[model samples]
Target: MSIAPKPNPALAELAVLEGEWVIELSNAKFLPGSNSRAQGRVSAEWLDNSALVMRQWQWRRQGDLDHRA
Candidate 1:
């Protein structure tokens, strides 16, 4: 038989971030040639109450799609 350990107190505190977020970046002068604007969505959740996992989907102003898993 196996038992799961309790989550760390500090880690559990991070549960407050468990939700969806809308992100926007405007006039970011990182690129040399063109101004950059982006919109994205982030989803955060706790996995098995042990690990915090975040997934993100983003679209650049030029219609480029980015995803992180």
Candidate 2:
């Protein structure tokens, strides 16, 4: 049998950030383009009994392929 881990009080405050978010960047040097725009999505979730907030993001820059981490 497995027992669920208890939520950490300290991490509780970060729970508010657990949701989908939109990020926008303009004229980024790395993208290197005229009026370039970088649009990305960020999603975070609590893990290890709320001890850590893990995030996975993906982005696309003008004239560039999708990037993820």
Candidate 3:
């Protein structure tokens, strides 16, 4: 008899966000004096040192992700 290996929950959660993600917030304020389209970019990658790092950047300028105004 053969038994299948159990899936790793941490890996599963990490899988969902393993790729680059672009998100936009419509008419939302992010900072104290920011009231415009909030765009964000998320990057997830595993380093060669066996460490997983997630980086994100948010902007409210043009040419960024549209917040659907």
Best by TM-score: 2
Query: For each candidate, C-alpha RMSD in Å?
Result: 3.3, 2.7, 8.5
Worst 10 residues of 1 by lDDT: 56-65
Residue 35, candidate 1: Cα error in Å is: 5.1
**22-62 in candidate 2: lDDT tens per residue?**
99888667767768889999898777665555478999887
- Give the Å error, residue 50, model 2: 2.4
Clashing pairs in 3: none
Off by over 4 Å in 2: 26-36
In what order do the candidates fall by TM-score, top score first? 2, 1, 3
lDDT string, candidate 1, 1-69, tens digits: 978767877796788888898877776775333566676777888877788888555544446657454
In candidate 1, how many Å is residue 15 off?
A: 1.5
Q: On a 0 to 100 scale, what is the lDDT of residue 41 in model 1? A: 79
lDDT of each: 0.71, 0.80, 0.57
lDDT of 3: 0.57
| Per-residue lDDT over 1-69 for candidate 3, one digit per residue giving the tens place of the 0 to 100 score | 976565555565566666677876665464333455556676777654244567554445445443321
Please report the TM-score between candidate 1 and the true structure: 0.59
Worst 10 residues of 3 by lDDT: 60-69
